[model samples]
Target chain A: MTALINLVYLISVSLFIVGLQRLSSPKTASSGNLIAGLGMGLGVLIALFAPMESGDDNYLIIIGALVLGSGIGLVVAVKVLMTKMPEMVSLFNGLGGACALLISIAELLNFHDSGTFGLAPYLTTLLALLIGSIAFTGSLVAYGKLSGNIKDSWKLPMANMINIILLLTLIAASIYQLQALDTMDLVYFIMILSLVYGITFVLNVGGADMPVIISILNALTGVSAALAGIIYDNMIMLMGGILVGSSGAILTILMCQAMNRSLLNVLAGGFGGGVSSAVQVGDQTVKEVNIMDASIILRYSTNVVFVPGYGMAVAQAQKICKELEDMLEELEVNVRYAIHPVAGRMPGHMNVLLAEADVDYSKLLDLEDANKFLNDTDLTIVVGANDVVNPSALDDPGSPIYGMPILEILKGKHVIVLKRGMSSGYSGIENPLFFHEKTSMLFGDAKKSLNSLLDELKTIV
Target chain B: MHLIIEILTDHLTILFALIMAIFLGFELISKVPTVLHTPLMSGSNAISGVVIIGAIILVRSSGSEDYISLFLGILAILLGTINVVGGHAVTNRMLQMFRKK
Candidate 1:
């Protein structure tokens, strides 16, 4: 029995490694998932069959739990939309943390003698309990913020200061509990306080900061798992936990860099709803053309660049955009799709949408790669995109998104913007690119505008 | 020589597990150039054979008291298999869509 259990553990670990590796790339990610699922199966098999000393004949209890948890997981995995993935990920991480906390608490309660518990077990148990509790509540808050159940902006002022005070209190309580070895009640009280504090701290943070927070919370859950493994003296759990912890930390840091925000600022709840209202339009002489005229210019241009944004997704114009590109290509005009990192609500949102439309992978260039070509291009068609092409980022210091790298689409010989109306993006900043001399606003749905452009192109051909 | 083999055998289980992890990890992260994400995601869904084998091995070897474990393992294996098959079918459909003239 022990041998089989050990074997299963070994197999599960291997699957987990493969799963993580596959996740790095779009191509093999599915394969990696399958391998990971295999590993999880192995782990569950070992955990269930491997004889525990617990004399409770609670086989029915365990079976019931397995059924309930698996059923819930199955429903979530099958029914959840891709748009809600980040929130789902946060919820999943919370479940992991909650499971870790429950198991650790059970272990602590079952401890017959406090004297038998060494420094290693005690320290690990305490750390796991603290981190798991934080992750569980933090993730729930993130889910709420992302799903719009909670307000997207700052709910309370001086929230940071309050969080700091609560943290200090939790720390002092933990220290006292550690010192006062006899008071189990004190430890329990400290744990409960810290759990509430964790939830409130996350609740105060806005949705804009969730990407980084989610990654950090995931890492915390991993740490909890590792601590749980230490408590159980399980090598498989230890390795798996470490892998998740390290990788999650790396991912969190990367996300922070992508947004050009410091990890410290993200943790301190620096992001909120109210955007800076300082408009800096210093008489940079501009001209605006309507949709029909913009199409005429695009038809005659030798080279054209299509820039897509979050608005494209809202309009579901990916297919029409592709058709326009095809039409442009037919006209013997060079065409390419310029994508910005933060173009959509979530990372890879642009990529997924474009992929769905079967856009040529080679033609799709990142912000840095595409920025150089935009200046020389005869026509830069800004389709349902705003903030990414906003020139304010480059010129105006007072702009909220100042110094953030953006595709300089305004520099192109001719620019046409496909937008329904003058609406602010997620950052709630005005795009001066709309008023630029070389730019034109084609006011309508992106799909309808692009379809019209395609028709115009066909007639010209 | 005997000692070396004994040491290898003792840790062989762990070694094999790590190797599988390494392979899967490598395979997972190799992003299908953004263009391939849809097909790849769908394709990977069908690779449930590994889970099935693991579950079968576990249940067959598990003792009487391990009934709960066996049941859970079997259930996991079934779900994993379904995910793999369904994922691949979706990938195929997605790819076929692109091929439409």
Candidate 2:
């Protein structure tokens, strides 16, 4: 029976691997998610048949929990808007972390009752507890930030100092527990401290940096689950956890690379605090373009590129933006979207938003491809994006976002920026592009602005 | 010292499994396109829900009188199910948008 279960575990692991492999591309991603879900279902069902010493029939509790959880999950999954994807992901990540943390705690209790003190089991349990606790609270904080429940202005003084001290204390306590094989009191103490650390660690990070924090927390949750797998000697758990852990790590690296910032730099907090008054916009006069003028410019253009940012998601302007794109296409103007990797709240946020608006995937160009297309484009329409297209990132070393990669939209023949007002971007950095020679500011709500522009284009065409 | 050595020897195969799984994870995910990053993340987030199995195992072995472990196990199972069900559902929903367009 054990051998048969192990064989099924092996097959389920293969399904997970194959599912992830299929998720790498656009065409198979949906089915890939289904395949992975199938693996999870099989693994959960087969776990019922696994050998256990206790004869207590707890199947009722298990089935009830599963049904209740599935009911809640299905409702939220169906009801959540695409704009809330990051928050939903963060919430689910937190649940996974909490699940792992609880499992480790339960196992530890069982081990204590059985008098099974050993270096291996205790070490894995401690690791899982620590990582799982952190991931849980950290993820919830991230969700709060993303959902606007936690304001960016909320800060704890000496945040970095506090984090370092808490971490050091956690390490010290963990060492003592391992050395002394301490009682449950010490374990509970460690868990509380870990949870506190999680909250403090993420509380100070500015809103713009939530993506990196989410990715890190996701990775931490995966690592904790993997540790739980080690404790239980379960191959499927081990494989799935490692896979998620690595994916999150890779994503963290990619996000950092997109912004040209290091992981440590992000974790240090204080990013996107507000505009750095030190770097002024100087004497460059701001250029303003009316809807009529902007429409005429776009209508006559041979090649036009749209740059989207988080504001597009906030104002729900993606559909209008897509409508503008279709209008331009009817005029025989070449239209494409330039998607900066870190453009929105999360990785690939703009792509998903645009895709939801029914924009063809092929019309979206990544950072590299978009830059190549921007070089010779007739005009660039920036919809609710600022920082990603800022020229200071390339030229002014004094700027806070100096070294980050930008769209270089100035390379095009003309530029039109649609925004709500003359404000700094999410990072609170002033954009020189707003005052540049070739740029024209079209100030309004992004969706309203796009709607007007679309109307004006109708008159022209 | 002898007990420590015994534990290490017993877990040697599991350790190897860990190392291989880590490598396989990195290799499989390294080539994913940026556009799919969101779905990939949510999908893999669901996979981490496999910890549900451990919760089940723990619950099954705990006696009914052991209220602490039973409560913890049930809660773990609940949260794990949410992660699995919601994560996959959300990822599929997002991917459906990408596929339809």
Whose lDDT is greatest here? 2
The digit string of per-residue lDDT tens for model 1 on A126-235 reads: 77778878877887887787677877664657777878888888888776765555746766776787688767778765454565676677667666766666566665
Best by DockQ: 2
> Native-contact fraction for each model?
0.05, 0.84
* Candidate 2 residue pairs in clash (backbone atoms < 3 Å): none
- Report every candidate's CA lDDT: 0.62, 0.88
Error of 2 at A316 (Å): 0.7
Worst 10 residues of 1 chain A by lDDT: A105-114
Candidate 2: stretches off by over 4 Å: A270-279, B1-7
**Deviation (Å) of A77 in candidate 1:** 2.3
Please, what are the lDDT tens digits per residue for candidate 2 over residues A164-264?
99999999998888777747777888899999999999998876677778788889999999999889888888888998899899889988888889888
Instruction: In angstroms, give how far residue A132 of model 1 lies from its true place.
Output: 2.2
Alpha-carbon runs more than 4 Å astray in model 1:
A1-4, A112-115, A204-206, A271-279, A282-288, A300-304, A314-335, A357-360, A373-376, A381-386, A397-400, A444-461, B1-101
